[model samples]
Target: MSDRSQLDESGSSAGEAPAVPEWLRRARWVWLGAMLLGLLASVVQLADRETLVAEIRERSPELSQQEVDAATNSGILFTLLVSALTLMVVLLLTNRMLQGVNWARLVLTAWAGFEVFAMFITAIGLAVLGRGTIEQLAGQSVSAVELLAQVLVTALEIAAIVLMFRPEVNEYFRRMRPRLRRR
Candidate 1:
């Protein structure tokens, strides 16, 4: 029998699986682009610490300058750290997905879903609390460009999720599945 037809320990032919689709390859790039946009948004927010501090002071005039500074600085640092970590995760997961790891696709989809839900909850909370508008909540940005970046990133994430679920991509994942060994 030819090597392609020979069954391995998994009882499956070596060449049984289909190749990854072009759309899925494009989706991986979109995912990376979204992560880059998110990182940019975080940087912009970090640079707007003065505005954040001023807003805090306006909300509570009783707060000392030292307290406002500490709060703003720490908050910006935390956001920056989180954004950096998220970028790392996106890179790792994208690489895995490109390699046709089924779990990676599922995990990335779940992560994107959670992010969308969180953004919605945050927007509702901001509106209810009489804080800034939805645009402001979206990116913590005063500039239009920053706001657009935030919106674009969210859209890209949604698109990536859809692309991952396409029939061709699903077939690729199935083919990439590892063989299970009996005990």
Candidate 2:
């Protein structure tokens, strides 16, 4: 196809999105919900610090729990961090999708993969890295990395959904799919 054919008179591809879709709108809402939840978790974690310490002292009598600040870190730090990251990436992807940038879709894919990796790390920590033999090391601050992953994954999901409406991306996929033949 000719270069001119790639785009319309407005210079954006004919297949590019002009506005965010209902699904994306819903995704945005979901992202907003996650953000609120993260914020709530942070607040609760902050408040729970004293309670956790008191419980530890009364129960274990040998364990020490550290203080937490919502603005910085807390028990829900990883969740909150991930929520913030997801929100930022979704917002950016939503903006880019509306602006009709095809490359944004590719970025979304990469971000999603990164997010899955982060989630894996988080799962590892939540399991083997929790209150085990090396509890102190596991408790060390490390939410930022997970947050980055959340944002990437959210972006990837939103991008994938948005790409569904994108004709160019679909055509590319269709071409890439293997042809099926009846025997």
Candidate 3:
């Protein structure tokens, strides 16, 4: 049989599907867990409706009560929308990366880098201003559950990044590159 005839729709040889390496599989799960934890963190933050309203009011003192309520509701809606979109993007990128799409791995790496940078900036800001400033800004204290979730998500992302770039995973992607390009 001709080589072209032996290739499947996915560009793999014949009926064989690409096998995902353990490293990539573990990385995918860790990354997905981080996303779920982040969503949970958002839910925890939104649990305090009074605090949300108070924070909104404190930030915009000139806003009337009606305006404050509107802002609070809009903020909640916006957060939900953004969180949902973020989850979808993460799912797509992780799925593609697992399928040996090298570009997807790079995109995920960039996202992890961005998250690390953001966390660094936040840490420095918190340290410089101290805890009192955070309470003042938010008009309330941060919940332990939210803080725990954020920390766990950070750790999980770091783990995922490490796992995704392991030697075997890199080799797997390398082997798949030519096959994928032919399609």
Best by lDDT: 3
lDDT of 3 by residue, 14-124 (tens): 545467889999999998899988987897798778999887876789999999989889988898889889999999999999888999999988898888887776577
The global Cα lDDT (0 to 1) of model 1 is 0.77
Task: Encode model 2's per-residue lDDT on 1-183: one tens digit a residue.
Answer: 865358753355655423334554454454445445445545555455555454445545544333323322443566567757766876787565434444554565566566567667766766685634334555333344445545554554555555444555444333323321111
Native-to-model Cα distance after best TM-score fit, residue 57 in candidate 1, in Å: 2.1
Better of 1 and 3 by lDDT: 3
Assess each prediction's global lDDT (C-alpha) against the native: 0.77, 0.50, 0.84
Model 3: pairs clashing at backbone N, Cα or C within 3 Å:
none
Question: Model 2: how far is 127 from its true place, Å?
Answer: 4.5
Per-residue CA lDDT of candidate 1, range 83-179, in tens?
A: 8898889889988898788778888999888878866775566568544565455444345556567668878999999898898888777667652
Query: For every candidate structure, what is the RMSD over all alpha carbons to the true structure, in angstroms?
Result: 4.8, 10.7, 3.7
Indicate whether candidate 2 or candidate 3 has the larger lDDT: 3
TM-score of every candidate relative to the true structure: 0.72, 0.42, 0.84
Error in Å for residue 166 of model 1: 2.0
